[model samples]
Target: MPLDAKTLCLGALEAGFDTGYDIRKAFEDGPFQHFQSLSYGSIYPALNALLVEGLATCDVRNGDGRRDKKIYAITDSGRAALKAALMEPLAADQLRSDTMFAMAFVHLMTRDQVKRILDEYARANRRLGEELGRLLRDRMCEHPGHQFLLRLGEDGSEMWARCIEALRDDLVAALDDTREAPEAAPTGGAAAMTARDAPETREPGSGSRPGPDPHHPRDPR
Candidate 1:
């Protein structure tokens, strides 16, 4: 006797609420708590489908607010459906991410591959940091709500970027001293060469055969 989580979340938006945090709290310790709570996985898709159904529209503010956040709002049809959906039963939810599951096996990979992953991950984190910094500096200041959201995201990104950089630097330092080519060990033939015979030379037009070329400067007559 519960409404679908997606519909319920959209209804909340129609009731002058939007943003992921607002919807999450609306479900937290509420009637919708009986159903699975929303996450980035659920929220983004639900919002997109809502827009496709003409039930919502986003208000993207460009340039900056103080911390730049693009806000979303709901539409008229969204309100009527929200009321109707409240009476309907909630559908079951599925939580699956293959990428995350694959990452659990990262330690099983070769060291070189792991190092590459770390470097790529650090660069990606740094890019996210730069983008978030730009957003905070350009906008998000006008409203306390938006400013808080921007700061929240920025702080999280900054922390991750720093962690990634530290790990990558450590890996690079470890690799530097470990990559020298091993000196060719003295084979039995090389040992015999030093003991019994002078170093053999390849004659002109010879096909990789070792020969005694006395005419060579190193081979005395």
Candidate 2:
């Protein structure tokens, strides 16, 4: 199932996280690191909503005169909700990658730009693989499921890094071939200009623009 932010927060509490920050950290560093991501923008609001709905309780802990911290714990109702959510049929997996989308237009980019992109992508995956390796070696590999997830993340990162490196080599070879080829006459025309100026397609329900409002008057002047 596609777990909402609130359900994820509840699960974090069930997993022993006490605050919204802790919940975010759980996603960043724990077994969920590979498959899930949560930001404070979503985490704090979800925690507040959970408290309002009586699914969770918050404790105001006094700090050392700097700031107070709010710790959250799941209520019985929250536990029931979490369990029900887990038992629900899983939703289809969603894969969203802005990198992949940009790759579709790689031919429009210079070789240097393509190389830079591939370098950054490989570096990021390498860093993630290292972090997962450390976690698996240290505390996170005790549980069977945690161990499996950590290994999955570590292996996936390594595989992606290798794939990106291969892509870099292929791109470089293609660029070399393009440079060696004889130049053709420029094909500049209205059709080419229109194609270049056309806007990229946006996904459905992307909400990049507001829907029409019946109450608003259109300005004709």
Best by TM-score: 2
lDDT of each: 0.55, 0.76
In candidate 2, how many Å is residue 168 off? 2.6
The parts of candidate 2 lying over 4 Å away from their true place are 29-31, 183-221
TM-scores for every predicted model: 0.36, 0.73
Tens-place lDDT digits, model 1, residues 1-221: 54555686686586455776667754553223323466667777788788888888877667465654446677788777886675566556564644336445443444466567766766765665566556667743565654565565566666765665554544443333222211333546543333222213322353322343422232144
Highest lDDT: give the candidate number: 2
Q: lDDT value for candidate 1? A: 0.55
lDDT of 2 by residue, 9-74 (tens): 998898788988888999988667778889999999999999999999999999989689998999
lDDT of 2 at 1: 51
TM-score of 1: 0.36
